[model samples]
Target: MGRHREYDVDKVLDATLCVFWRKGYEGTSYADLTEAAGVERPALYSAFGNKEALFRRVLDRYQERFMNHIPEALGMPTAREAARHILFSSVELNTRSPEQAGCLGINGSVAGSDESEPVRQALIDFRAAGETQLRERFVRAKAEGDLPPHANPEALAAFLMAVMHGMAVQAKAGFSREMLEAVAEQALSAVPGGGAAPA
Candidate 1:
């Protein structure tokens, strides 16, 4: 072998994700990433090129590790229950861990700019995909008699996504899990079925 790699790529990506999740894209410096990832600046640059490239790696990893659950959540029995699980799980993901708080994609929004078109588009696509999935779930729920016949599945999905993102932003602002749950409860309560909503 030419040289032995001193750092683990998986571990470094995990740590980098945590750092970005906590400090956000712009807030995290190269030094912060190096230190948090337990690698020197040169190593980080060698591995990832720059902060933007590194964040793309982190975001990609986060999508696979965390956000891929969206499809499964949508596949559940009822849209309302799926909505509840998605929101509550997001709250748990954001607040239950000390290593990172908030979502990487949501945090990415803070640093997103027109110049960062790829990153911004990725986040937008993530949100749109989520909204579409939620809409499908709502459509299925309505067909199954779990929701009112007149409910607009697409609009309801968009609404639930709004609630999810709002809660994620609030969680990033130091909201507690219980508080976020109450937020979820209130949002769910506003649905047509109240607490009896299925999913």
Candidate 2:
């Protein structure tokens, strides 16, 4: 009989996320993954197929671990509160991690082109889903008369998305958590009547 596999699949994928998050998909190699994951190359190939397949798995796992909770954060009592939480959480995510990979969605996707169409599309889809969730929250706020009747939920969502991606880029450039928090505070201040603006 063949030798039994020893490592956990979820653990391996989690490690793979760090490798790809820090290096990007194209930047990471088989040796990089193997070393980071502490798994043999043969085991990795057996479990994840190829490099692209492994990267996709890593993305999916990351989404499950990180992205899925975003909607819950947006479920705060008010739309503005939810937006603040999302922004602050993103800043925290980038700064708190020792890996300093930036936002995987922003760094990996924005850097990719037609040659990396599949990965790029995956990132776009993830962002679109996030925007949709944010828009719905804004729509609920508008219905509650918390926002101006003319406020467009879709536009607000798009603007927030842009701001988020900008933060991700800046974080990758080594901006500190304090700087990111200041940016978030300014963005939050721009929201109409969200209490007193930061001093």
Q: lDDT for every model?
A: 0.79, 0.80
Candidate 1 segments whose C-alpha is farther than 4 A from its true place? 112-114, 193-199
Count of backbone clashes, every candidate in sequence: 1, 0
How accurate locally is residue 54 in candidate 1, as Cα lDDT from 0 to 100? 87
TM-score of 2: 0.89
Candidate 1, after superposition: displacement of residue 47 in Å? 2.2
User: Model 2 off-target regions past 4 Å?
Assistant: 110-115, 193-199
Cα deviation of 184, candidate 1, in Å: 0.3
Best lDDT among the predictions, by candidate number: 2
lDDT string for model 1 (41-152, tens) is: 9888888888788888898898889875586778666666677778777778778676577777788777656666766776788678778777877877888788888788
Residue 135 accuracy (lDDT) in model 1: 82
lDDT per residue for candidate 2 within 1-199, as digits (tens), equals 4878899998899888888888777677789999989999999989899887887888888788877548776767766777788888888877777575478877667445565787778778878988988888888788887766888888888988888899988888889899999999898886654532222
